[model samples]
Target chain A: MVNWIGLYTLTSREVGRFFSVYRQTVIPGLISSVLYILIFGFTLEQRISEIQGVSYTMFIMPGLIMMNTLTNASSNTSSSMLQMKLLQQLPDLLTAPLSGIEIALAYIIGGAVRGMVNGILVLLVGVLLIDLPVHDIGGTLLFLFLVSWAFSSMGLVMGQIAESWDQLAMIQNFFLTPLSFLGGVFYSIKMLPNWAQSLSYFNPIYYMINGIRYTILEKSDSSVMTSLWMAVLLTILFTSLAILLMKSGKRIKQ
Target chain B: MPELAIQIKDLKKSYQDVFALKGVNVDIPKGEFFGLLGPNGAGKTTTINILTGLVFKDSGNCLVFGKDTVSNYRFTRSKIGIAAQELSVDWFFSIENLLFFQAGYYGINRIDAKQKIDSLLKRLGLNKKKNSKLRQLSGGMKRRFQIAKALVHDPDILILDEPTAGVDVELRHELWNYLRELHNNGKTILLTTHYIEEAELLCDNVSIIDEGKILKKGSPKSLTEDLGKSGITVQLTQESIDKKLPMLDLDYSIEDSRIHFSVKNPELVIPKIIQELTSKNIAIHSIKTETSSLEDVFLSLTGKSINE
Candidate 1:
């Protein structure tokens, strides 16, 4: 059986967990977004006029939204799972009448919700602060949701593999953070040399940034179809891997 | 035949090369209070984990209510609730909220679980701290909350692994009373502990396990009567201490100017020993006889103290 009630309860608990700590989970991302806008968007706009058809401050809004979305989304699941493992609370969930898929799905939904909330809040900030345009509101929301789901699943994978807080930080600092910055978040890949542009194509996060950019600004360095396909592929890939690890009871089970 | 609540056949589990359970077999009938008594590293927790589906056995069958734990996990798990040995809980959650969530995990809705949650809190004397986060509770409160969480779903069988380990005497007694009440209400409980007193007090049957194998299994009274031995101690005077002991055809050892003899009936042998000592001119300062307990049975079977 699907255990819908169990899944719902677990997902709500995950959601309530982050909601209870709004100061730590929600405010920090919004505050960081404002800082990025004031420091990078305003100051750098005076030096460089506009990247696409929009002002420099407006140009970086999509990237800021993507950055906050993926970061919060991934961190929600990673931290939650890792903390439960470290505290030895996993046996409660494991011994419950929930299947592996149900558990993973609950975690994914929790992370995705956090990710989407942060991403949308950043979008609202951009629209209110700088009058940032939304070329396709429906497409923008869909893209944000896809990116959140994908990164949240990936975060569960990282959480399952890393045994300690230090290891999780290493994975986030060395991998996710670097990839987000290099994924052409602040600037388009066109600004990069041909060699760097070729390397950017290999960064999956680039497609997420490019996809969100297309929906919000109606402008993208890569093909719109390519970005959409990349988001879909990554979502399926990470979700499958998360479910697999959960079913095998890797690390979380003896 | 009366629908055993738990059954294990040749249960074996190994971590790397070291075995945690080796061909273990046990059957616990419905509504029976069973205890698995063993010291540290004796596989008590491992056996509980296997039965609860938190661990996978290398090769064996663990059936709860006649359903295989591995193949029929949903049914088996839903019927058995476990208060694990480790204090594993989310510290951020309040006791009430955690109980609600636990009930929800068992497919019970909020309204359906409220009464059970309230009753458990009141029964465990945790109603006052219902809103307190788990981290803010004391050790004894945390233990009670663990049991509450396990019972919120109202499973047929409750498994407590070392429930009273490290608890104070008063709280231990309180928990024992609550557990006894639950048992009287027709709840089957499987209790594992190294405390011989706990097993003797709470369990109807006990299996004495040592080093991943069960050495003896029976009622506490039966085991003590069958495997245990009574003994008499005679404190000798200074001059008689060095004298050769009487040829009593029994297991006897002399230490610290006292002669100790292990016999079945201390009353029958005490007079014979007193007469033998008098004839040898061994002056006895005092004499004391002791009856064997579960601890003595454990010592005799394992050849060492249970706590050792």
Candidate 2:
């Protein structure tokens, strides 16, 4: 009744699409994460020495992992959807007897898979780079998955809104990229002024970064409980929006 | 009288203040090679899109195999395979991979899908290019691949929206032959094309649509017959041809050293005209018969050529 086979095909297609261009999709994120570890984790950590009783390398490791994970997840869905729309391939899936919810779930789940893979890869890279500890592996994985699902769903919404490659690039370059970097990836929010610290609470990526940081190093500038709730809320929020847009055929129907 | 494969009743859809389908009604019986002929902006593509769930209709009902398009959207879609005018397959995957994935979407298993895809590739002459990426394919190859994608699921109805838009003459003929074979094997087909000749040759029943409404509907032969008569022209070396040929009870006109006769049946009328001209001491060079074609019927109904 659910057309499970169709759902599997779409998910496989979406996932295989990213995998087809591993040089662009998977390798870039891995290389960036490794570089961040080498330059900042190795060099900058020497200056900062320690933040909240952990080395700065360990402090930034979770943030780097979360950053690359979410970025890859978001890029996986947004860039793929935008390409399909421009190339006129979206109609193939649309006509494939797949329900709107099934289509959205396949794409979102595909993004989440990419996100989780890159996150785990970065985590492994950090373990090798600085011998980063795993204080709570289960919690880290669950949070990584939730963040991936949320960002991927957000990417779907972005893809629906964008009409061309230029518009897609603007969303990624101006919004997603800047938000991830400024979401306290490099430094803890505790170092910011009180006003800036208050503002950091609004950046959803902040909760993700701190949440993973709490899992790996058992250190945080935000409450783990609050971060968990924020991740769930964002996941629900973005997934619902994606489904609604897809079902209504918003901005996509001819 | 027959089972309806596709039934549209007052289907309406308007986009950007332009009505793409204004109360369109058509019933495609099972196993009929139906043609929906229309010029550009004639809503043929829109009709296919709505049936496939790419576009939502503004009003009215579209049913495929007794399943309402909205209420049973997935079931309706699973029954129809559409080869759209625009190339819509993903460039990311190879031809074989794309077909395999497409088959899987229709719930086909890997082994069955692989066999079906292989058979399609061989039948479509795409075996050599199976491994090639879509971007690496020629325009003709891309068209062939589009057809293959649509057939991967083996749907009950195949909707071809201008399947041979820019294909070469030889390939177009081959494609028509393949489509005819499919129709003979009990596959329902709905074709839309600008090439009236394609429709003339391949369609069992056709509906000419213009401005989002049906202007004419009948078999190509029947439609041509409804025009009542064909034209016959004789080129004469000597032209004293200002005479109405009273022998055949028809009117004759002359232009460019040729005498034109409006005949009800050229086969029966040409010889009589030849006899009458010879008796009148007219030198006849060549005689030509221009039978009324679907083009003529289209012109009479729509007041414009198919290409226009």
Candidate 3:
């Protein structure tokens, strides 16, 4: 049988590592989310007024939450792995009785926790600033959990393949940032033309944002069912890719 | 039979087009202080990496405590502690925090991990710096911390890759003394170093590898004795002694006021060499006698110096 005690200890260490660096991982993201809310919600509210049926502030709250969650989750795993690698402390983990699954799970879950913390912090801040209401607390929590898990796995994969600090930054700059922005973080698909809206349907982040929006504001650009299924599918896809990369140990083993 | 802590058979590894290990074989019995001796660019680090499961091999097999390293990695790995060649501790973490995290990685509870961490830091002379961040510690202290971290798990085998590379002589001796104590306590140690004298003093058995191949493998005494029968050195008061008359029946070179020579037997040839030199009225200042060392054997075998 696998050692649950060992898994828990490792997972705790991973979580603690990120928590210790809250300034870089958590606080900055929270501050940025608040800034985005103030600037986009109030400034743009005068021009656009409302998105779908909800106020612009409420419409963008879910997007902001998703953006913070995904970025935090990815940064948590990537930074942790890179630090372990650079410090040469990764050998300690490799020499342990823990399997690749255990290692991957520890990192992914650590990222998820950080993501959730930042997401909740941002949401709480949003409530204070804009009076946002939760239409479906259960669905919102579920979407937050799934989206965080998916991005965290992606971060782990990125960490393993990255050989230098520059490579790690490249993943964030080139792939993650673009995906988050295009994932409908700032604007709803309903605001787009028919063709652009159809294209947004393929963006996984769009589903996560819309799903979260449906839960929090009860007004989404897409159906709740479609968003739920897309979130689940993306989670499975990203998790499998992460696991496969970790198992191969291609760039990591050296 | 004593249990073999590590066994390798025809192990081979390659990186892209460069082969790192070529059909290398070795057996390390439990509780022995073994040294993997070689100069830079040799396969010493590669061998350690393979043993620790940080790198994969192209072919051959390896077993740790009789468990296959490839198939039974988790179990075997749990019994091994590796202090990598590079200083690999998180610079952002405090010394105490690093140890606690390492202990946790091995599944130790917080209560038990605290005890182990305290004892290790004390033994390593790092208790005062427990709260110091890794980046703030000196190089020697960082190296010692790495060793302390490795030992937190209390594995049966301890692999130290050049643990004393950048440390001063005193700290190096302290480190060696600590390693000796660990060996005395029945821990199987696989050490790699460029210092031949260090290997000669601490290792019970050694393997010299070069260019991804084992050049020689045996106990230090056996390998030294097998290289050549004996050696002799004659110190002269003047460097002009060689210009006065040609020395006979021996090949010698004057290096730093000393004339050194190698022979099958120093006792039988020493008297003749002395008489031959004296016949020309060559005045001698001092003389010394010795046997071949691992350095000599390595140079003769690999056609390259250990420090090369």
Candidate 4:
């Protein structure tokens, strides 16, 4: 019970820490998503009309939301942990009565909240600019929450292993950005060739994006069951790895 | 029962191939201000890190408040607070916010935290800078704020790793007074310092360590008094004192215009030396007597200067 209270306070501090800089954390993503909608959804509408019976604008909205969710989630956890490390404030947390599990959950939850906020903001912008229709709002929300949770845990792992600002930037540049861009953000899998479609199936972001697309557009190239199962697997795998890293006091502690 | 606040036996730690602490043994009793004195790279930081659970030892046992550090880490850590040697705080956070956040980490409620924060801020002279961003404060103010942050949780034991480094004399004195007050309130403190005078004044007991080992451990007075060897100096107008003051039963040497002697009792030997010099009709320009100090004891025990 006491551990839960510690976790709650820690999570609140982590969340509040980022929100205090909301202009940098939340507003830019909203503006970026609006820009994507204007340039790619409207400007390129003439080039590609519809994908799987849904308008191109509506089809790309879920991908954009997932992109924002995963990026924000991962960035929130990784950057918070890295900042604590750089400032040497992590010792305060480490010396507290909280356990490693509590610490891990606090960071992951903070990431999830930021990711969800960014995703919702992107969704609201999509609705305003492109009139995106919601097919299954419940499923869409569920998928967004799960993806946020998964990526936030991944971010915590990255933050632990990263030793410097350059190393942190390298993870985002070399891994996260590429995975996000290639997760079928602007195009459907049917539009790609056989080999490309096969390759897209291997990217975990593909499942996240397509699963969310299934809920928001009612039209998905990937199977919903497969996507859901893949997301759950990724969440479990990433969360377990993050917890293990924290428990072992990997690069973060000593 | 008088509790043992900290105990370590055969503590060892290494980073990669470089050994930081090797076979260290120490015990600090409750309600005492203990000093760990060593030069840079002498493993003082490593010992504190291990006690704080920021670093794992390669081999050893460390107990805090009667609980094993490794097995009962959470309980052990909850009783201790540390102010690291480095000045590390979030530049974005105001002093008040940083204190509140640190209090929150220890599961202190906001209502209680605010009360504690206000008192700590005032005590540390940080009340004026409570709302100031950490980066905006001067170096000395930031250092004081760190001490305030460490005290917010109100742990039973406080460990300060070179807390007064880079602080000016006035602020250092202010900090010493604050720490002394904390000690008077029955808090056990473990301090690591480079300033020998600071240790002599603040610590109730001290240990001198070098090359990852303890060279001496005792009260500052006892440590200095135990090195009772004294030195005497005499000056003459002539450079021929080397021949005048021949090798006697006492240890003596001549350098330039001065003659130097080392004896167990300066009072018993100084009169005899003066008589010999007078009988020889040597003009004594000046005479001085000196006894061993803590600095000399440190050098003799560590085989190296403290500032080295």
Q: Which candidate wins on TM-score?
A: 2
What residue pairs are clashing in model 3? A87-B88, A88-B88
Model number with the top DockQ:
2
Model 4 Cα lDDT, one tens digit per residue, B26-119: 8999999999998888899989888888898899999997899888887888789888899886756688987887787777877888888999
What pairs collide in candidate 2?
none
Top-lDDT structure, candidate number:
1
User: What C-alpha lDDT values do all the predictions have?
Assistant: 0.91, 0.87, 0.85, 0.86
Over 4 Å off, model 2: B233-261, B268-287
**Stretches of model 3 off by over 4 angstroms after superposition:** B233-287
* Per-residue accuracy of model 3 over B240-294 as CA lDDT, tens digit each: 4655655476777667677788775566778887887778778788778876679
Q: DockQ scores for all the models shown? A: 0.63, 0.69, 0.56, 0.58
- Please report how far candidate 3 places residue A124 from its true position, in Å: 0.8
How far is B29's C-alpha from truth in model 3 (Å)?
Answer: 1.3
Determine which window of 10 residues in candidate 3 chain B has minimal summed lDDT: B238-247
Span of 10 residues, lowest total lDDT, candidate 4 chain B: B239-248
Q: Model 3, range A1-254, lDDT digits (tens) per residue?
A: 67566678777877887778788778998888888878887899889867777788778888899899998998888888887787676777777777788888888999999999999889888888888898888898899999899999989988887778899898898877887788787787667899988887777888888899989988777889999998888789889888888777776787
For residues A1-254, write the lDDT of model 1, one tens digit per residue.
Answer: 68888999999999999999989989998999899899998899899978887888888889989999999999999999999888988888899999999999999999999999999999999999899889999989999999999999999998888899999899889989999999998888999999999999999999999899999999999888999999999999999999999999866878
lDDT of 1 by residue, B236-264 (tens): 99998789887878889888898889877
Candidate 4 per-residue lDDT over residues A1-254, each given as its tens digit: 45665788889888887898999899999988888777887888888877888777778889989999999999999989989999888888887878888999999999999999999889988877778888888998889889999999999999999888899899899988888788888888778889988998889998888898888887777899889998898899999988889988878765
